[model samples]
Each structure stands twice: as structure tokens, then as C-alpha cells.
Target: MPNPCFSPALAIPAMMAALLCISTGARAELGGTMSSEANSIAAAPQTLLNGALRLRTVTDAGNTTINEYATNTGQIIAYTWQGPTMPDLRALLGRYAGSYLTGAAALAPDGNLHASRVARPDVIVESGGPMRGYAGRAWLPAALPPGVTASDFH
Candidate 1:
């Protein structure tokens, strides 16, 4: 913005304030509450499953929303409220639901969802890859408890 009428310094600040206002406005729409409190409590369902496969922020910074939820059934679900019915991901991840999982996940350099196993970080790949990584959300090998048929859910 090198206009004779506009100052670059002023432009930058104005842009920043506008961004802040928009960011805060989005939060206000979410009831003006930071996820810090809700996230931990909300993540409990995953913890109780395997304790090992738990929700993790994609990275420590630059990410404001929760990004991933690893389940007891060796599946990693991404969390992004971008597309239609992304809110359904929560119900799909319900305690009784160990099947469907689709949130927002970026593809890696390999064009695959970044998935990780328990006790592993940044090492996300299955020897055979995603089970049925298509449709509304992807489904992994749902490790149903003994005597429980996988067909029961469908």
C-alpha cells in the first residue's frame, strides 16, 4: 500500500485491528468462551477409550481449534468445522460409536491423512493405509469388544 495518500504504518495497524475484531467476533459467536476449559473436559471420551489414543492439537501454535482425536480403535479423526455437518463428528465419536470419524484433516506430502499410533508422534501410517477412507467420514478397523459384531452398528 504505497499510495501517496495512505501510510504503510497506518495501514498495517488498521489491518491488524480489523483482523482482531473479526477473530474476537468469531469467538463471541461461540459464546465468547475460549476452548481451553471445554476442550479438556470434552476430550475425556477419547481418554477413557484407550487412554493411549487421545486428542492432540495438531501443533502447539497457530492452531486455535482442537485438531485431532485418536480413538481406542486405532483411528485418528480430524476436527475442523469447515464443511457441512462437521458437528456430526462429535456424535459419530460418541462413547457408543466407535465406527465413523471424519473431521478436518490435511493430507501429508503423501496425500494421506496424517495418522499416528499410540506412543507415536509424526509417524502416522498404517501398513495397508485407511480402511475405508471415503464417504461422509473414514472408517478404520473398529476394534469392537469381544463378542460384539461390527455389523451391529450399521
Candidate 2:
């Protein structure tokens, strides 16, 4: 007799459930108030743009360095990352995740999976890199502070 645990029907549903759990457990912070989740994962915060923005740097287990930029009011407005792996968009984008997914899907295939850009009126995400060195940035245009521009994120 075959083992029921190895059955394909059971495995498929189990995988789906695992994915759902993973996604739901991830929190979105973009456009949201500062939360302990960010602080818990990052080192000491640094002020930037002449005190117009706050930057938190964190190195994940994967050795990826992620920099989150927030306003003085504690609202995260942008993120820049570089490492061997890409950061979780679903978690970083918060309410704008759906817009990114839709825009990315609509992009014309350039035959280069290593680079992609989503530029909508509300959000702009540019990510690309080779196998072991990835870099990207995601920011909210409307949330940028006075005299601050997208180039300042990098």
C-alpha cells in the first residue's frame, strides 16, 4: 500500500496552505506608521537629507542589506536594497503591492528577467542585478518630503 502522506492531492493543498500562511504573515509598512517590526529588524537609525528623512539599515539572514527611508512623522516612504537576494515586495509595499504586481505584469517582456521597472503615478520600483548582486529601490512619489527627489533614495 502507498503512503497517504505522499499523495499528490495532499501535497498540493499543503503547499498552497503554506504559501498562504507565509504571505499573510508578512506585514506591509509602506504609507503606514512606523512599527516595531521595522525597528526589531534594523540597527540604529540614521538621519539623512539634512534631517528631512530617517534611514534604517538592516542586513537580513540572506546577507541582503535593506535601507528603509521614512519621514520625520514616522511614515516609511521608500526602500533601497542590495544583496544576493531580493527583499519581499509583498511586505515592503503594503497597500501598493497590488499596483506593483499589475504594473509589472503589464510590462513588455524585454527578455531580461534580471531587471524590471514599475512606474505608476503612485509608486515607482526599479530593481535589477545579476545572480549574486541584486539592487533595487521602491518609493512613493507623493510621500517624498519637500526638496527631496527620487535620486536621493540611492
Candidate 3:
């Protein structure tokens, strides 16, 4: 007798669904606490910045190295990334993803499809890269620690 519950046709879809659930659930959004996702990402030991901030670095499955800067109290304030592919902006941007998408959409095409810059009073994101190389940064202006600037992230 064959196993009715084990159809090959259903296997791929089940596996894909499982992967989607795992990826989405494992992300830690910007402007949020980092403990949960940090723990899962094989994070390096947190580094302190003059006692005012902390930096946590992690490399995702795509080999993108992401550096997340946070307040001493654990709120993520900025992120920088570089790798062969771009990281998931929606996951990294958290609540600001909509703003980024909107701002990007409003820009006139500059003939560069792979590059975008979104600047708002509360948030800023800039990214660009070629076929096999990518780099970018996103940050919250008000949340940045005193004496810390956007250039300090990369």
C-alpha cells in the first residue's frame, strides 16, 4: 500500500512554505530590539562605541555582511551591508519599508535601475551595486547617538 499523505506533488510546496515561514519569522526589524534575531544569526560579540552605542555584525545565508548599530539600550538605529546580493530591505527596514518604497517610486528614473536613494526627515536609505557586488546603508536620523554620523556606519 502507498502512503496517501506523502504525495510528491505536495512535497515541494510544503517545503517552500516552510522556508518562507522560517525566513520571515527569523528577521529582526530596524527600530526594534535585536536580541531575538541577533541570537539566531551567529552574531559576533557586541562591540561598544565609547559607551554610547553597540555594534552587532551578522552574515546572512546570502553571504551579505550586515552591521547593525544600536543604542546602548538595544534599539537598532542603523544598518550597513555589503555582499554579492542585496539584503531584504523590507525585513531590515521594518516599519519604514513603506516610506522607502514610496520615496523610491517618486523619483525620476536616472537610468540606473540598481541604485536608489530615499531621504526623509526621519529616515534615510541609500543603496547601489552591480551584478555581483552590492552595498548600502539605512539609518534613523533622530535615533543616532550624539556625535555619531551616517558615515560612521560603514
lDDT of each: 0.26, 0.68, 0.68
Clashes per candidate, residues 3 or more apart or on different chains: 1, 0, 0
Candidate 2: the clashing residue pairs are: none
The reply for model 1, stretches above 4 Å from the true place, is: 1-46, 49-53, 81-154
Question: Positional deviation of 65 in candidate 3, in angstroms?
Answer: 0.7
lDDT of 1 by residue, 20-131 (tens): 3432111211101223223422432334333534343322122223334444443543222212111232232333121111111221123223222111121211111122
| TM-score of model 2 (CA atoms) | 0.78
Per residue, candidate 3 scores C-alpha lDDT tens digits across 1-154 of 1112211221222222332344442556789986724365656447566767778888877888888888877888988889986677777887887676656555655545455566777778777666557777889999988887887888
Candidate 1, clashing residue pairs?
A: 115-124
Weakest ten-residue segment in model 3 by summed lDDT: 1-10
Judged by lDDT against the true structure, how good is candidate 2?
Answer: 0.68
**TM of each candidate vs. truth:** 0.20, 0.78, 0.78
Candidate 3 has what TM-score? 0.78
Best to worst by lDDT, what's the order?
2, 3, 1
